[model samples]
Target: MHIVITGAGRGIGRTLADRYRAQGHSVTGTARDGSAEIILDVTKPDQQRAMASQLRDTAVDLLICNAGVYLDKSESIVGYPTEMWAQTFASNVTGVFLTVQALLPNLRKAKGKIAILSSQMASHTRAPGGSYIYRSSKAAVLNLGRNLSTDLRHDGIAVGIYHPGWVQTDMGGPAAEITVDQAVDGLMARFKDLSLENTGCFDTFDGQAHAY
Candidate 1:
């Protein structure tokens, strides 16, 4: 399988890339710092186009839209700034969309699956207060994934939105419930089971259906 992963510099994205490569799959991992196979800042259109050009005519079996930011964490309602919201949405929502848009042709060639790493926080039922910017961005991406699933089904492509669990990563913190490896193990299983019949489904890393 030829897999493309964004934000592979660290955390769950990095781990996912490593595991896939270890399994002898062809992995195209991207990071903003140029440390991976591709240097892609998902919010940048030029970079997105450059990536598409690099992988042109190649069959991308899987595209993982994992580049995201969780700014505005612990911010009070009045403390949230406008710029924070803009940056968050750009990375978490618009970035995901642009990546999918740029790679549409490659995905079509392989009838690939798209795995969008959303969060349980994205659910309306999970709203418990702060991190408004992060929560809203995630929710928006979930909506984007669902809509993309519907449109891409005709192309024989599947899209699944996921909550990768409270992972022990820079974003999830040390106190988080699951280790990066644990989260990756579960996520890989979910990704493996993704198909047209389950497209647009919101699910947890462990395979449970998540609330929209």
Candidate 2:
């Protein structure tokens, strides 16, 4: 499998990249910094297209839209800074939207899988109030995944949304329950089990289905 993963400089993205490479797959990790195979800033459409063009003649078996950021402080829904809200959407929601759109042609050609990194907080059924920016952005991504699944189904592309759980990464913090390796391993296992029958379902790394 030739896998393209974003946000590969650190955290679950980096771990997943390493694990895939170890499994003898050709992996291209993208990040703003570090020794990424592709240098990409997803928030920038030109950079996203340039990166996609690099793979124009090739087939990508899996596209992992994993780049995201969590705002340091929580905001009230009514009182949130518009600038901060827009920035959050820029990376978390819009970035995923553009990255997938840019790569869809390649994915369609290969009949590949598209996985978006969402969060447990995206679950409407278990919605807890707080972390307005982060939560709302993740929820948007989850909804995007749902819509993409429908839009891309006829093209034979499988789209999914996954929550990596509370892994011990920079975003997850040191006190998180799982290690980066564990989370990525679980995610890989889930990815392996994906099929058209389960397309568009939001799930955790453990394969547990989540409510959208």
Predicted model with the maximum TM-score: 1
| Candidate 2 structure, TM-score to reference | 0.95
C-alpha lDDT score of every prediction, in listed order = 0.95, 0.88
Clash totals for all candidate models: 0, 0
User: What local lDDT does model 1 show for residue 183?
Assistant: 99
The lowest-lDDT stretch of 10 consecutive residues in candidate 1 is: 69-78
- Per-residue CA lDDT of model 1 for 5-74, tens digit only, reads 9999999999999999999999999999998899999999999999999998999999999999998878
lDDT by residue (1-212, candidate 2, tens digit) is: 99999999888888889989999999989998855888888899999899888988578789999999887344566667888888889999999999988888888788999999999988878767888888889999999999999998898888899999988887788889998888888899888877678889899998898877
- Quote each prediction's TM-score: 0.99, 0.95
- Clash-forming residue pairs, model 1: none
